[model samples]
Target: MLEQKHYDVVILGGGPAGTSAAITLARTGASVALCERSRYQENRVGEMLSPWIRPLLTQLGQWEQFRQAGHLSCPGMVCCWGNSQPYENEFIFNPYGSGWQIDRNSFDRSLALAATEAGANVFFHTLVVDVNYEERFWKILVRKDGELRSFKANFLINALGRSQFPHTKEKIYLDSLVGVAQFFQNVSDFAIDDRRTLIEATEVGWWYSAQLPRGKAIAVLMTDRDLLPVKPKDLEAYWKKSLLTTIYTIARVNFWHSANKLHIYDARTSYQDSFSGQQWLSVGDAAATYDPLSAQGIIKAISNGINAAHAIASSEFSHAVSFNDYNEALLSSFATYTTERHLYYDRERRWEHTSFWQRRQGNHKFLYA
Candidate 1:
């Protein structure tokens, strides 16, 4: 048994939000520790960063590091929204300039490494089994490198991409969006179009295809949970049928053939009833999740990371208040995102009667459940 450890703050989950908060607070002289369970052994899908994220990276003092990492430049996005002809939203229109199509595994690892370099103790391959709040501090039990360890902190940050607090409850689930993807080898040879990302709205749902740095490309279908083709053969057949609904994807999937298997993941939107308590705060997706169509997940997570640190510093350092301001602001943002999501979804009138579309149109709701 290792001896107990102590820090001013402890963060769970070493992805962008946790690492970003650690970098901000540790540099300000706070003792910070972050626990991360894996080194990204699975395939991740959120690989595109919009141009608006460039300034946020600069604020994190990571712009130069991100530039030197050699990620592919994202030209912009092309969408088949209300009509069949694709509309282009180029990066040139963004004030912060070019976006990125990243290899998420390398990008996330870089952020974690940067946090350690900023003086935060980082525990890779560690899982925090349970957290107990007692007498103005949190007692965290973790399994680290095949050993159990104990740690204590005055403030805890949940960046685990899901709520881990008893005080907070999910007020509502806006929709049950699902993202199913397939990767094909050697796709660059067949794709002669501009390297920009392609998104098309179909009868059943929407589809996304992006060119990667290697000779590969990833294509995903976004629909509701109820629409997922569960059976092995059915999923394959449905994916092909959905792809064929769009002109941009018909040729792309046909080029690869139906050889690779599909991977399905949650892309739902929901907000916690509360975002912060006196001793703990939830940042990023743990606080609120957005639709994948927004392309704002990465930016929101990094920005929230910085905001969480600021909220902590302002209150406890001044001995004035708790985290109510943080909670209010997060809730406000969630409301605005919900409104915007509905507007974009309303644009696709072709499949209004379908279950996937009906869910987004706000026709069905177990509101406040």
Candidate 2:
């Protein structure tokens, strides 16, 4: 006979959103299972976290723990957008003070740890092989270490960032934006002082670079997929050539240090047709994804997780439970995000005639992929 376990809630993808929901539900005396695909040893992206994240951590009761994690403090950001002149968006003026530049792997593990401490079953290196809904319960099959485990839950939360299951709705992509990134580790004793993130806009696209903890750093180039001048085989060469076009971003990199190979990932703005259904709902990047320029992906994920947990808890013992408010809030936020994104992109008129800018300026219709 196969091993089978049941829980009040089963969350897929132990990212910020999943762990947030798990921590919340577990604290409320609800049995929760949080499954993560990665083993937590690999490096993940999305390094910068704004100061606004403090409240969310505090709400989850992990603020002090996060403070002691030793992540680098980000005082502000430096941008060269709209024109050649660089400007500072300092955070010292804000009441929350400095944000953080973290090792994403460690950050995520911390959240999962919090969930476990809150009485949730946290599973790593677990892959969801199948999902089915029947008889008012979610039947999920997961594979871990050559063994298959079955789980049944009264409610399911989809926090699977960027990767959706077969039951989820299709994602409507607003654009084909992608990011080519490279990570580096300082092999020698090279002292550097500037900690603010750098964003330099060029005719082709934009560049983002930041200093991470432990003498590590990352630099990424954002551009439309179709706008890439070279094919996949020549992407590394193209990445280097594009770096030469930047004014300030180039100064932030140390070519002499050992760097990882170029990594390409989707950085587009997209949303699902629906966010919630009967006994199931999506959260974080699974429901909607924002452009990295907003720098609110993780924040949005944590917020969604917390909200979803409440919705589930409220409906657990009642048949009249409704997720309409949750859906409406997500839609409203997306609408506002779209408008703000348009205005931000419009600010860069130097590359108006370029295909990359033209698509973002509403000259091109949204394409389905």
Candidate 3:
């Protein structure tokens, strides 16, 4: 038999968004419960952090913890594009501070453990089955050990990444976004030569390669669903071969000889939902997701989580005002990133001698206002 429990807040999903929110609320003396369906050790990409996340982690006092975890330090980015003739540019983001490349599994679990240490009740391997909202509270149903258990909370946070709730459908559709990544070990030799990470633009989309703290390298390829015919089962093979054919990648083949050791990071789909609802709020990918070409996944996730926590703790609204504020912030961030991407893409497109480059350079669908 399962026991009944009550909390001031119940957060679904234990990724950066949920854990950070729980940690913040717990510090404010609120009773919080976090539910994560997957085990903490699950492997995933989105491990690269951006320059903007440093202050938030510092404020939360977790900067030292992240450093101790052996995250790769990245001072900036180097981007290359075009074929027969290519233009390469390096942007050192040192003014914004150096970012870290993490083992997401370890990083996420660390956040969850931090939440626990801060007094948030943390539950792993527990899946949220259904949510029933009432006039004063919410009834959350979960399946544990083949039995259904229910709990109540004064507030609920829908941090369920990529899982759309019933009310979220009309707001946004994520069926268009696509992402794929891989991890390779024994890459120390390449690390010494390629001091900074590289982002190469290709026909399908963009690709990123960076060295991890271990003697490993992480490479990711991202594009829209409309451009590629990738099913879940064959996504690995499709991404591997597709990446190898890119002109820039072929130029740097020597650095990728250990490609055979590649471990596929599952290709993922995502969408952005308008942040508006009562008694429930969505943060991180649950609210909005940018194309991975921006490499802002974890940074955006943690930043939004911190913002959501502040809004929830300080808000006086009974409805969705707080969530609306969060949405505005995210849109602003995305706007800046989209602008930079277009600039790089346009410059590369103009330099190419091939038909593919001409078409890509002409394609301006992602241009931002």
Candidate 4:
């Protein structure tokens, strides 16, 4: 029989949320284990880290290190949101200087590695296939290095992105949100302003495009499924055709040569009905997934992990109410954000007659796959 290993906390998924939680717990002299199933990140979409992320990094004691990673700065967004004419929302207006546009792989790896640097035991290529309560602890069966290993922990944290955990029910705030994206490399250089992130909304949907480091650009369209082309065989042509419909993208992107396979991403806004139960809790997308418009994924995950750790470390009286408070607070905050989303979409009256805009007029809360 294999000997069972134990830690005070076991964090599943080595992404920002789990790793952040692991780092926070380990800092308090708690034995924490982080099990990451994959050593690699899959195809990821463009990520625009908000200017507010500066303080979040500072709060986590990773400002210097994150800055050293050398991601490209996105000073502002050139938006053609509700009108024909484009406008700019500069991050310079904020107290923080600029935001970041990252190659998603590098961003995630930095945080996970940071957790290891903070003295948390991080196991890569490890999958927790089975989880159960045994002897008042979380009994986890993980497959690592082509072998099985058993782990026990007083607390278990799920940060496995979305739909991976069955213990908690997820409530979808906006169900019909998804994206189709294409990557362009060796893109021609335009004016310096062309380097800024670009957003333009059409009658059927909206488009987001940004120039990354190394002359690469990521352009994507977000819309309801019904708004997409019905034939998969026509998807390639449809993608290029639709991208050309954008006010800014048509002139900026070369559809003739830049045509490539479209990558579909699930962009639903949602949250688990319950964030914590017994000795287990969830952080990041496992707890809640936000609208891409909010751009709060990284910051919210870090904040959730930090708050979860502090809550667990508080007095008995405080600890008793911690998770509930956390859940309630996030719920309230998301509700407000969804309301704002409704208002934002409402501004585009030209598309009000379309199903896309008409649907958004309703409170769109539905199940996401």
For each candidate in turn, the TM-score is 0.93, 0.95, 0.82, 0.91
Candidate 1 to native Cα RMSD, angstroms: 2.4
Q: Model 4: what TM-score?
A: 0.91
Better of 2 and 4 by lDDT: 2
lDDT by residue (226-342, candidate 4, tens digit) is 767798888778777787677787776653245457888888877777788877788888888887776778788888888777666552323234477867766776677677777
How do the candidates rank by TM-score, highest first? Answer: 2, 1, 4, 3
Q: List the residue pairs that clash in candidate 1.
A: none
Per-residue accuracy of model 1 over 173-277 as CA lDDT, tens digit each: 777788888877666555536567888998788998886655667899988877776666788888877776789876666665333578888888877767877
After superposition, which runs of candidate 1 have C-alpha atoms over 4 Å from their true positions?
Answer: 163-167, 189-192, 256-260, 316-320, 362-369
Tens digits of per-residue lDDT for model 3, 2-22: 576888788888988889889
The clash count of every prediction, one per candidate, is 0, 0, 1, 0
The sequence of per-residue lDDT tens digits that candidate 2 reaches over residues 1-369 is 677799989999999999999999998999999999987897788758999999999999999998999788999999998999999999998788898998888889999999999999999999999999988888999998778999998888998988966786678888899999988887332534688988999888899998887778889999998877666888888888989999888876844368988888999899988898878889999999999999989999999999999998887635346799999899889888888888888889998998888877854333223
Clashing pairs in 2: none
**Can you tell me which runs of candidate 3 are displaced by over 4 Å?**
1-3, 82-96, 145-147, 170-177, 189-192, 229-241, 247-273, 316-324, 334-344, 350-369
Q: Is candidate 1 or candidate 4 better by lDDT?
A: 1
TM-score of 1: 0.93
Between prediction 1 and prediction 2, the one with superior lDDT is 2
What count of clashes does model 3 give? 1
Cα lDDT of all candidates, in order? Answer: 0.81, 0.88, 0.69, 0.77
